[model samples]
Target: MRIYLAAPLFNDIERSFNERLTSLLEPMAHVFLPQRDGKLMRDLVDGGMPLEAARQLVFEADINAIRRCNYIVAVLDGRTIDEGVAFEIGYGRALNKVCLGLKTDDRTLLPSGDNPMIIAGCKKIFANTIELVAWLRGGFLSARDAG
Candidate 1:
């Protein structure tokens, strides 16, 4: 299986969490982690690439990766959902790819919880990484056994 991991990669905390999650899932599937696979916008601009060009490159690369993935695992942990992650989830849903959510954050934008549209986009929302890993492994084992 191919997984497109969509998460906020703006800071050390977010990037580190994404790397850790990728490591766990790597043994099970081919994980397309943007921070590793795609060029960072900041890096490109810092290296003398124009801001617009960097943005376009990053956008295209992510979109193409999403198209080729079997599933999209979006990290929905924060005060509010990341705009890029939200867009990726919506895109993945439009492409009929399986969309899973990992939200460890207790804070919510709404009184009830996360936004309805974001929740609706996910096929299943995991409260923690352990649950997500277990669920994926179960599915992987089942598939392997069946095959």
Candidate 2:
């Protein structure tokens, strides 16, 4: 199974989260993490390429990885979901790939309710790592075992 992990890679905390989750999932499935696989921007920037060009390199790589993966695990736990993560979820949905939202944030964007669009986009929104893991183990992976 291949999983495309979508998250903001702008800071240390975000990068660490991506790395930890990637490590957890790597043994069970192929996880394409943007921070790790889409490091072309950092590399190009260190090589003196313009920041905009480096950004484009990352954008192209991540989108292609999303299209290729069997599923997408999007991190939605912050003051707001990262725009890139939201776009990845939408693109994955458009591609007919399963989208799993990992939102551990207690903050709510809308007090009344979550956006219907985000609600419907994800097959399920997991509130924690344990919940997410149980789901991965109990859902499609089990189906694969049976088949």
Best by TM-score: 1
| Candidate 1 stretches greater than 4 Å from native | none
Cα-based lDDT for every prediction = 0.96, 0.85
Residue pairs in clash, model 2: none
Work out the TM-score per prediction: 0.96, 0.90
**Candidate 2 C-alpha lDDT tens digits along 39-73:** 66777899998999888887888888988898899
Poorest 10 consecutive residues by lDDT, candidate 1: 106-115
User: Against the correct fold, how does model 1 do in TM-score?
Assistant: 0.96
Q: 1-147 in candidate 1: lDDT tens per residue?
A: 899999999999999999999999999999999999987999999999999999999999999999999889999998899999999999999999999999999888788989888999999999999999999999888988999
Q: Which RMSD does model 2 reach against the true structure?
A: 1.7
Lowest summed lDDT across 10 adjacent residues in model 2 is found at 110-119
lDDT of 2 at 72: 95
